[model samples]
Target: MPFIDLKTQYKALQPKIQRRINQVLEHGQYIMGPEVKELEEKLAAYTGAKYCITVASGTEALLISLMALGIKTGDEIITTPFTFVATAEVIVLLGAIPVFVDVEPDTGNIDAKLIEAAITPRTKAIMPVSLYGQPADMDEINAIAARHGNIPVIEDAAQSFGAEYKGKKSCNLSTIGCTSFFPSKPLGCYGDGGAIFTNDDAIALACKEIRVHGQSQRYVHTRIGVGGRMDTLQCAIVLAKLDRFDHEVEQRLLIGQRYNKILGEAGVTTIVQRSDRTSIFGQYTVRVQDRTNLQKYLNECGVPTAVHYPVPLDEQPAYRDLCKAGHTPASKKIAGEVMSLPMSPDLTIDDQDKICAALLAGIKQ
Candidate 1:
């Protein structure tokens, strides 16, 4: 079976996808086309954010948000070490310091309880990732940021586009939120695409300007920026996918819950999603003591498995010197154990059953 069944999803949305692509083709305004603006508007309204700036990719979305906030050399941005490297990469790319905080053992998300201690006079922002489609404690994080002279908080919602924390959407849960459309995300397009959502008008305006080579007007460079606009074709594809995104999110939640129940009864340890938040099950990860052996066993049994992350960023060679010395026991422990099973909206119950059975058999050996 496929790890992420994009084929199945594409088959289902084929007609709408074709129509949208055709519209974009006919218009022939590939860059900054009408579809781009339309997608930005729809996504902003969907997330209840005042603005959504479409960017080239999720990484670009984070970079652009930091640029908008004027992150610079020596600026400290506190974030979790237990996520995709892109989470910390953006911070370091701008000559900023990535203060690696540990994550919660259960959810594998940034530990908001540990953030305040890491904050200093040089700290510019707090960037917490919504790992495995589950949002971290944004309310608590925001409260801490508020206490610290209202520092900006950025939610790296790369794996949590359609997720919810309380009644609010993931991408609108903090000062600024960024999400990806890397063809495997909860609501992805065919190619690289992403958006930054915010209620702050000034930040929103800055992001919009930064997305297009910092052009305040045609050929008018107002600020240093990257070529980070998501093209009209990609936007069109995402707009088509939006037709059934809500229903897809529900399906993903149901599938994730079923996986949790089945795996738990079979004595497997899975990541825990909190009651106040809904995870889109971006990877449907599980924790295992002997991950390497279990992965090999599963492979032998024809069950594909992958690790979300094997090394914490703080331990990475390049980041080690850049980060402050601290004992992040939880991040280190979780990094060695987390493994992801195949997950997609179209993943069948039968396939899941086989996978769980394989996992159980693998664990026994």
Candidate 2:
């Protein structure tokens, strides 16, 4: 089975997608077009955020948020090590330090209890990644940030656009939240697209300007910025997808829970989803001993598998010397054991059962 069934999704939404694309093409306002505003407004309403600034990519969204916050050289940003490198890459790109924290073994999300201890006077922000589409312990992280001089918290919600925490959407749970619309993501467009969400008016304004090279008005450069605008075509595609997004999210939840239940009955160690929050299951991963062999076996059984992350960012060559990382035993251990299975809203129960049977058989071998 295809890992992420985007083909099936596209087929289902073909008419709407074609119609949206046709409208954009006919208008020829490709850059900063009306569709862009329409997407931002709809996304903001969906997330319950005051503003949503669409950017070229998720990395750009994080970078722009840091710029709006005025992250400077030598400023420290606390984050978990067990996530996509983009989380720390953005920090290091702006000459800021990413202080590494351990993650919870169950969720692979930052350990909120350890966040406060990582804080120092130089700590300007706390960035928590919503790994595998489950939001980090946001309320606890926010409380810690509030206690520590109201340090801004940015939720790296690249995999969690449709997820919810404490009844609040993933991208609106913190001071600033960023999410990706990469083709494989839960609420993805056809290509690279991302958005920043926040209730802070000043930060929102700054992000808007920054996405267009810091333009306050036509040709007026107000601050140093990057060309990070998401094109109108991408926005149009996302707008069309939005029509079926709620149903897709529900499908993802049901499929994820099914995986959890079937795997649990067989005594498999899969990622845990807390009761207080919902995971969109960008990757329904499981922990296994001899992961390499298990993956090989599953592949042989026609079950595709992938790893969300195999190496901790702290252990990477580029980041080892750049970021300040203390002992993260949990991150280190989970890095080797975690393996993601095929996950998508369109994944079928028959395919899921075959995958689980293959996995259970592989584990016994």
Point to the candidate with the largest lDDT.
2
Model 1 ranges with Cα > 4 A deviation:
none
- lDDT of each prediction vs. the true structure? 0.93, 0.95
Q: Judging by TM-score against the true structure, name the best candidate.
A: 2
Q: TM-score for each prediction?
A: 0.99, 0.99
- Clashing residue pairs in candidate 1 (N, C-alpha, C atoms within 3 angstroms): none
Across 256-356, the per-residue lDDT of candidate 1 in tens digits comes to 99999999998888999999989999889999988998988888888888898999999999899887666688999999999999999898999999998
How many angstroms is residue 178 displaced in model 2 relative to the true structure, after the best TM-score fit? 0.1
CA RMSD (A), model 2: 0.6
Model 2, position 100, has a per-residue lDDT of 98
Cα lDDT tens digits, model 2, 239-274, are 999999999999999999999999999999999999
